[model samples]
Target: MPESCRSRELPASLLTNPEMVRACRARDFARVFRLVKVYAGIYPSMIARRCELTPSRVGEVMSGRRQLQHMDVIERIADGLRIPGHMLGLARRTWETPLALATDGRTTPQSVASDPVAPASLPGAEVDSILTLTSRTDPSPSMLQALRSSIEDYWRRDDQHGGEALRPAVLGQLRYVVGLLKENRPAAIRHGLYGVAAELARLTGWTYFDALQYNQARAYFTEALQLSKEIDDRQFMANVLACMSLQATYQEKPADALALVNAAQDEARAAPGTTPRVLSMLSLREAFAHASLGNRYATHASIGEAHRHFDQIQRGDTDPAWVTYFDEPKLIVDTGIAHGRLGEAATAEPLIAEALRRENSTNQRGRAFHAFWLARTQLGLGKLDQACQTATDALEPAASVASERVAGHLREFYDELAPHREEPVATAFESRLRVALPMRVSGSPRP
Candidate 1:
């Protein structure tokens, strides 16, 4: 192990610290991460490397954007940070003696339990009474308001931090909303709950898709569709199907993506009061699908229609929350990307740069993505020095963020830069890449 690896022999004082024990028992990973940093004197990147996770993932957990739920992750945290096994709800530390051996030959070790004693089981009648009492208390107006606020917060965070960092917590909220549906509530409340639940499911699906977890994304999209149908909300359902269509576009199923977007348009036509913003987003996806298929004429037509619809969207329009992010800047950047894919780098370069300039600094993931695109465009234009510099600028964000899309773009940039490897600028970029990213080497060609 490297000298930077956390030692298992954490100081005895920290091991027995009351606050550390409490934080662990509460599953407050942020607190635990901080305690480990403060006590173990290790960097977040070192902890991430030791745990075999992305640095942004560690930051996400510490920032409450992701939860440490999986047993494997929990165990890795214990092992990497040298946290006490008992602190992570595990058996006693390996150094501790076994308390018993099962007939199956498994050793059960005793742990110093710091939590208070368990409560006594209720009598059968009391249990029934408690259940009835709980079910009678439907999800409150305040609770629904708070969850909506949380959903909006999730959207904003996802915009800034990217989907990989937000998926776990978003999924947790989805599960909670689903559970809320099972409770007794008024018809109106149930209807409202359906709306929020459907949005959450769609958001979760979008995040999962962004993270490149296709199967999980599909599952959430299916659930979102079902929830939307339950409320008979055609507009909302159209939006979700549009989301699915966008995912299909990225998954390389251009035909399927086109079909889904067409379906979304059909649903929008039937919607009672679908906003122009929603229609514009669906049109944008249609353009994306066409671009994937190399149908330049159709792609241009769809883009034109999208622009028209977007122009119709007035301020104070009652558009869905999800579609609010689809502004002129997004349309321009996406159009540039479409043109770039078709080998129109000359036309793509300025548009992409303009969009990047307007983009907010807090959106690190977005910056990385656009920066990669700009680098690729510069490379296509044979501006090797600029390309190398732009690509190098992308590396810092790529190193710390857990984004499969950004990572994939970086790989493609490396491949594109391969032929130019003998160039000094390319060589310098590779050297920086080797230190900045965990990607495979792109220095020498394979024989």
Candidate 2:
């Protein structure tokens, strides 16, 4: 068969699969390409040169030519585009399943636990729903406000119920909101929506990181940081920096994490009182960075500083628009988790348990994290039964949310129990852990 004709001979299954067709018909291919181009800025031409493809060829594939069916060719394009493997469907066939199942893949009940970056896979149904919503031109002001209000409600509810109970719902809402943002592209909406995009991107990175999808997570984080910067929101930028620091710590680069945290601290200091909540968050980041670096004294100092900032927040403190979500209890819970990471099980246990006790009054997502850390502390102390129970307890909340950071902690806890796989407590814990973790595409191990 002639090469050009051979492309035509390729099975429809290869080029016209539902996803491929959707990508083409919905113009997602072009959008994704454009996003990449915009993200690459001056480097798009440079990237094309290195890939031995003309800039026009790059445009052609992105513009949805029906003949681009070769997997190798798609991969090369993705590489040149700097698209994450998972997003490009190059990681595994996980996207074939529901988002929940994809999220729980290899870590199911029977399999040995593995780390996979488990970002909420954009389900076909969800994508269609988003498309339907976005297809409308000039969405009504009330409708746009309604969408924004709905997103705000998710954040508020997540804060109130704890992140766990509201995670899946929140993720669904976020995906919808992102679609709306893409469709509308209104400057006024973009001002606020940029922060939302950064948050979503951060969450996506965390999920991917937990699923051991480092490259994808990294890409998401990079995008998040850039978005945050574009908005010129210092607090959000600091949060993104803190997130990057956490990623560095998990990747076992404590120095890098510390550096990022320090940079965040500098940013936070420069803009004190501009966003007290984010500033408090930066303090927590400092604590975590110190903990990761094994600087016990510095960790304690940072935690104290965080606590002081928390104390300063009066009933009427003027918080930035983006940071209206945090409060004292949330700060305590976050600090507790950091202490746990530092191996201060004695200090961490009471604080975590307290956080869990009050979690019912706050966000389901935060509660899930508290539960995971409680389990980690228990595991550290060799309280296998308690650890198993706490770990199992964590799932109820975890299953409700879409944060990869929570999953990453669970994976670490699972690894901790692996050495004692013969013990009954460990066995039970392992079983539950598998259900929570599932196998990921990259097969990377947890820190």
Candidate 3:
């Protein structure tokens, strides 16, 4: 490992290096590895960590013994190394791609849409390329219905199989939706398309977030927020913001999470008839942010506010599909999570237990998370044996699912149990957990 490449980011020495850019653009992993070595500033160990590969695997890729073929691994490399997705046969990078400067010389944030026939950024026949690939016909009611049905199916599958299992399909659906947006259509259909597209984007974002892919998640959420804003869909915007806030909360940016939830609440309030349930969900996220900050009073107040709103939700009331999932069971689990974060384990225990019981078998991810929390609460209450048993139970369902969030909580539970390793029960639990959830190295590496 190169000593100079200790930091995750590219050292200043390689930031403006042309060889780095050329290798990246060509999607040449071996060439990129060679250039890093030649530059004498990047380490194979660091690359291994960034790409979620072992040092030996990194060496294999560099030595032409292994190929970077899987889309997931390719995405990791592109994202880790800041390679443009277009360079690797992808529609667009998961993170923001720099736009060609507008006529005013300011970098444009919006996609180039002035000439729908051909976007300004496309250098060649890519316009015709995707259209041909998608092979979409003119927009129609049936097409819209098909798209909505697909989104619903993907959402249902996500709830059952977790994000990592459904991310690719959701991403593909999103790309197809984007292609439809380019076609000329009636105002109503176009608006509907945008609405569903926004939902799809949000759903994809959530899946990425569940997998702990923060950059991709944030980018998709940003796209959803922008689409909702274009249609003045304040309610949808609030939901997207709430999702972003939740991600921030989990990422340990409590202040930023609070700010985001505040913005979401404001937006929800402005919507024509935002449902009480929707507002309650946002309020719950606010409580979560407060709990993360160790603000007991604020957290309790927010929890109360959330319950009040939740109580006002009438059955059979019209609501978007997304907020409909914020039923009593969800509220209980979220409240338990907030209280648990505040170290009120006794207060959290029963609620988490009840939520675990109430969650459907299809919701394996939720069950795993709630089960882990129940164990954590047990630990906090000094019920060491119960905690160990509950944590062991949590791992089975979690192992069957593909959610990084569940994996993360399980890892935290393990860390909390570290001091008890000498105990036989703790030792057995640790042994099982290590097999179920191996620890990833801790550090964020930007390319």
RMSD list, candidates in order: 13.2, 11.6, 14.1
Model 1: per-residue Cα lDDT over 259-375, one tens digit each: 999999999989987888888888878888998899989988998898899889888789877777777777788878878866779988998889988977677778889899999
TM-score of each: 0.70, 0.61, 0.70
Provide the lowest-lDDT 10-residue window in model 1: 113-122
**Top model by lDDT, which number?**
3
Which residue pairs of candidate 1 clash?
Answer: none
User: What is the lDDT, from 0 to 100, of the residue 304 in candidate 3?
Assistant: 99
What's each prediction's clash count? 0, 31, 0
> How does residue 85 of candidate 3 score in lDDT?
60
True-structure lDDT of candidate 1? 0.77
lDDT of 2 at 47: 40
Worst 10 residues of 2 by lDDT: 2-11
lDDT (0 to 1) per candidate: 0.77, 0.63, 0.78
TM-score preference between candidates 1 and 2, better one: 1
Error of 3 at 28 (Å): 18
